[model samples]
Target: MQHSYRQLADLLSKEIRAGRYQVGERLPSVRSYAETHHFSVSTVIRCYRYMESQGLVEARNKSGMFVADWKIQNASADKTTQGKKQPAPPSVEYDKLISLQHRMTELYSLTAQPLHLGLHLASAAPQWYPCEALSKIAQRQLRQQPWQIGDYPTGTGLPALKTGLISWLATCGIDLEPADLLITNGSTEALNVALRAVAQPGDAIIVESPVYFGLLQMIENLGLKAIEIPCVPGAGISLEALEYALEHQTSVRAVVAMPNFQNPLGCAMPEKNKKRLLRLVEQYDLALIEDDVFGDLSHQQERPLAIKAWDKSGRVIYCGSCSKSLAPAFRIGWIAGGRYQSRINSLKLSSSLITPLFEQAVLAEYMQSGALPSHLRKLRERLVANIPLAIAAIQRYFPAGTQVVSPAGGWWLWLELPEHIDSLALLRQAVGKGIAFTPGTLFSSSSKFSHFLRMNIGRPWGREMEQGIKTLGKLAAELHV
Candidate 1:
């Protein structure tokens, strides 16, 4: 029923998503793709252009077509299984995760906490914050209203903060009103509130493979089971696989995702795919929890739109925060609960009561002072600039066949180390050498990612950072079996 060019585009898209092509690798020329597939060059060109518009592939001025970094690497194992439908992932293993957590705790307790360097943490360094400006604002607020700190905060949030967030959300393409928003302690609390609002204990929630560890922890604590769908290199959750899951798994109650600048992976879901995702969720009547904490840290000039931007029926529960982009200690986060506002408010009232009023006031004033845009411009520039330096180090120092993912907009860099090396063992050795990074084993419910790891690229790049990475490389080499 599809047109020939559309059919060809779909076929090539599957190949790219299957790990047949690597990120930053050049695609076959239009002439060659046409000759091999027995299609006209013009048709192939049209297909390529369409894919470009979808953020799948990009055309260089004279260098030919290439896959965008945002759509970078597929799961390495997918290379051999191209065109085959991935089977339903096994139910999330609670015991395995608990053991992994224990091991992480032991590693941390054994290391000298202050002396150990954090290649493990994803937070920006203190120097990166606009401390001088925030200090001035805080002092002025105290001088103007000395009695403000004594008051109990509203259950939902301070009205002024909600109003400011309305304008802020507009920039991200999500139009919201004060009534539609609820402030929380941080994105962590926001996610917890959203999940609790939609799902009950013993329910099944679909999540991405190699998902953020915090979400996995939330699922476990809530006594919910998880079904992970493999993610495509540049695109987000495989809509095909998701639909298949929804068809067979009637117990699935909700799905969680980070569409823009996904954690660990750093890929953005294409706009078309986001729309399709909304439609699919609507078809099956499921709720979608969208985590957009890192959406503001794009390497490019334009910010990508959130999945909630396309939600028409209110099936999407949108969550975001200032924690990653600015003022981490302020603990400012919010949700545009769409259709779930009432239940979310109830949950907010039940847990944590409300976010701090004084902090919210400070954040609101700072957001409105025309200072945030300038700060983010500089922050984004610094974060993006660090990627190449980190990648160069990885390629030069790490053992060959050690694959690293160059994220498009986020601060995290994910690495797929050689199969023989265990990240936990490497972390132990690296910790002994005064460095620490998150082992990939912590990110999933299974042991499949034990050979992987994630590094924070948000920190300022310098000799100390480079040496730490080089040392990690040396340690990885030593651990190879």
Candidate 2:
């Protein structure tokens, strides 16, 4: 009961600090707030009282609460404007890429523990998924097809799952048939196949600066070079910079992008930029690997459209998965390989033969059951509410000059700490304190983002999660130079 009120208080506190309510502005009445959030009136009263104690709001005589003239406790706005001027694309350094791979391996081995607060991985807690529904579907599938367990995967994917994915992709404004889609182990495999379909050893692939570390590892493992283009916060890759790189980097064969809710930065590309990207790719005659794994988890009423949605030239190799949205353990991801469908299918066959049949069958049934939309809706709400809580904790605890990017959608919170605070060193200290987060060094081929870090707020916001953030902030402050 107490925790419930505190959660409300914390959320409101974040809003207040974000300038949603101005000084001396009247706040919603306790009763109104309670009714809107479905909290008890008593809980709302307690919340208001707590805020009053914290100097965030003040109670008026016989009137409602008002915003107090309190100093905003959150991190100040970032000094560096994100999208104002396009910087030249950074050269892809081979030595830096090798260092990234080694550092990532070390970090993963260190954080692979049951008790670690793993805010590094871009996945949500299991409770956020419809596990009971999926389990029931799996049980029904196995009972109906008893011999499925002993069977090997026959082709690229189960037909039923592909059919279901067709309907699901339509929701994201991407129109494709099952013939165009190939299922893989997850987005990881889907991206790998997509990259292999377009580029080979020594080929240069364009990637967002401070991109997902896994993508860097893939580039390194495949012996491909990356041309790092900068991305704007809350928006995606810079079209101007990308065009510049395409013009200069003659060996570039493919451009990999997460147009919607990019990992770490949590940015999406605008529709105009997406269309322009398609045009650019057609002009360059290079493939575009669109990773839309985070597309379905929109925090807004209308979901953002993917670059694949506007593709006409078939240059866009679309990749997505249920890993982030529906199921993690199932590892069900698909690719609409566009012009490279045949190549991707061949690669898929030679690699895994097929994605697991049972899990695909289970997901197919679950999707058709009309549960995914509601499940995603509830999951998005949880993420929306949880983001601010983490940000508020960061503001209250971290040292001054810390800047956090509050993305419109997705579970990540990208933070820029004091310039001298090495996030990797902070991660080491945080691990000692039973917390884990992604050091921004892993995100880039260069050490440009050594002061940055990414946090996953997909877990349920609670005392423990807040404590983890607090510990990370303390560690960051101690390392602040």
Candidate 3:
């Protein structure tokens, strides 16, 4: 077979396996595919016809070629014959099944617009990112492997990067061996892998009320039920409420939490509460998924200890990422699965092979050179300066009754608006004024946080941001009427 046709066929097969070309799913149009690939239209038509002859696809008039149902049946049979089980039949439409994708799209679209006070900002301004450092590392990598352009990182991820993580964690009082760590795309993938390793569908899980919206979406995506516990703003999750949920909800399989600089709220659990939560985990025989993505972005230089430090029984699954300190595009994160290391590693293999190797290698180099710590120090200083500016802006512009929590660390400030003013409606109005903030309704399944909004204070507090807050406050005042 010619290389062109073979390459196209391979691409089609990979999509089919990945379920993007699901059974009976329509393939891209010949003209579109040809234009995308920069190939002649005849070549594209030939590929489709070849697929049809092999019974891998079918054509429909006025529509397009679709993946043949027999292709899936054949694949299923091949799996069975090879002693591999086929995936379960999907219970919902693929688009409907992944709720986070939709929410993320909405968030991204909002940011893509030319906005002044986009409160959904997750990291620092792009100018603050270490792009030059990353570029240098990437260039060096290409120079060394001039001919090797295609290489997939195995599920284990880059060895040097994993070692770097182990060394870095040790500095924070987390003494995990390299074998205990599994690198993932980000903390999001780490959470998904940990959840799959420990829990099943319909299993009850303990989550903080007004928890991380992304985590809530993940829980819903996995078909798990969340038993929400009331959590204090300054003080992490309510230990008493957590204990009650654990004691009463025997079906609870895991407790997902962010012990330090938690998302949206920026609350760090006290040292005493961290110890108590670990004890409860052991007593209830549950898994603890600790998301610490924002841990390194603390305003204070004195790093608070991670929950994993108190995990003697190996039930804690500690997850962290450099998305805040470094950059979100890096997508390099890891999970330290105390005792369930191998299971999480296996799950990583089954999901995506691994993160991009070149990026990991560059990150490892950056960490070894102490660039990471230096960058983090600067980031912390900037955040510490920005936080007060944000609070002052809020106080000056927000309604008189509006309440705000001054977090000891992290870059987010949670606002408690008046009960009658819906945050979702406020968000719509804010966006119209070129402002964006996370509506509290996205934080929980119950939608009980209708009057709250999570503001990102990571960006510099300038005239644009200050003006945006004033506009948001004006909108809030209108809603009050």
Candidate 4:
């Protein structure tokens, strides 16, 4: 199908763009790529053909494929015009530095692998998903006369969905209106839209060190510069460092953060700190983009009030997604822009015509049916049960002196590995045994967490997973020794 081909093309393109492949580098043989990805060789061949058409790569008569040498003279010119002066002649491209150390067939090379415990994948939980219920809703929508899959979600999203979200937020003491909301493909897209709407290329954005890798990737792709402030697990970013950065860095355009159950560190900013941040944002006339993707997944029933709720001047852009709470595949997320709603909406329209309509409709129906609350309750219970199990496993199997952060919410465990062991190297060894996890370095601009790893605690424990953890622990211990 055309859809499948596009997916394959996207997968390959991401890898190539991420610099996993270098110019003139040989690609993995078709058989290897196909086997690793579980795709047919024919599909991979088609993908390769598509890549060739895009000038992303070239095929050799017998040596397989190589990344093409796209001239960056124009890129260099643009960078120069943008005030980026290079010491070198600009003839040296980063593409040349890309490592060809591993076979190009590894998907994990492009993205962080969930923990070996199989506990972190959003798709791992099936019991909490109301699949049949969603199907019924979709069926009902299709049964209508002259059925349409639904129109692309406008900036305001489905009006009913927006209204449902407003009602839902009211229960948490956050009052919002349909006019304040914008629907996005997911939290990732919402963050992308927010970044594009507010930040120009080369603008400085302050981020929590050991933050989410996905956000870091977004910042990199957009050419936005980031300043990192050390963040402690169970506490948020160092306030003094952030304040200093804001005061000294006049070019700083925004503060992007995850105040609740922050990715990788799983740190929740305290209420006082949230207020202090709000005040600072107001004082500096800076925008606050809050990523609350895991807002609903806290093990604690009483969730912290969102920083957006405290924004009086409409400086906060609050983003949330059902992907974390329900299903990542659903890809349903929304943004509440207190004052920047129209700007964000315009950016969304320019980027992607709209979020898919059917998925939004189905999600709206599920919310209206009161299924989401019950699902969250069950999901929270499951995560609470699994978190301790994962912790115990790590304690039992990991190297001595390893530190584990027990988050009050979210399904991630941030592990402080032995100082000498590199998480990336550990990841390399673990993936060789069909195990994977998010390395801590990806979370920061400076890659400060090279000695740490984040384990997903969402999946059920298993023998293979435990064995993998043991192997990793032994490896870490060996490195320590």
Number of colliding residue pairs in each model: 1, 0, 0, 2
Model 4 residue runs over 4 Å out of place are 1-107, 110-124, 144-146, 150-155, 462-464
**Residue lDDT tens for model 4, 159-229:** 87888888887765578877788888899999998888788999988898877767777887798987887
- lDDT over C-alpha atoms for residue 261 of model 2: 82
Residue-level lDDT of model 2, residues 1-481, one tens digit each, is 5499999999998998899988999887655677899997657766776777666777553245788767642212133444323221111121133356667765786687555688887789999999999998788877898899998778778998888888878877889887898889999999999889898899999999879899999999999998899997666888889888887889999999998888878877788888888899999999999998999888886788888888887899999999999999988898998889999999998888878899988998888888888899999999999987888999999999999998777899999998877777677667767788888888887878978999999988899998898888887777664
Candidate 1 RMSD to the real structure: 19.2
TM-score of 3: 0.77
Model 3 residue pairs with clashes: none
RMSD of each: 19.2, 19.2, 15.7, 13.5
Clashes of 1: 1
Better of 3 and 4 by lDDT: 3
Range of the 10 consecutive residues with the lowest summed lDDT in candidate 1: 87-96
Q: CA lDDT, every prediction?
A: 0.82, 0.83, 0.78, 0.74
For model 1, how does the per-residue alpha-carbon lDDT over 1-481 read when each residue is reduced to its tens digit? 8878888989988988888887788988766788899997657766876776656676553256787653322333346546433321111221133344554554466454654468777688877888788889999999999889887776688898888888878887888888899999899999998889888998999998879988888888888888999889888789899999999998898999999988889998899999998888898889999999999998898899988887888889999898888888888899888899999998889888888889888888988887888999999999989999999999989988999888888888899999867777677667768888888888887888878999887888899988989999998888664
Q: How close is candidate 2 to the true structure, as a TM-score?
A: 0.79
Give lDDT tens digits, candidate 3, residues 233-271. 677899998987777787899999888887778888899
- Residue 121 displacement (Å), model 4: 3.6
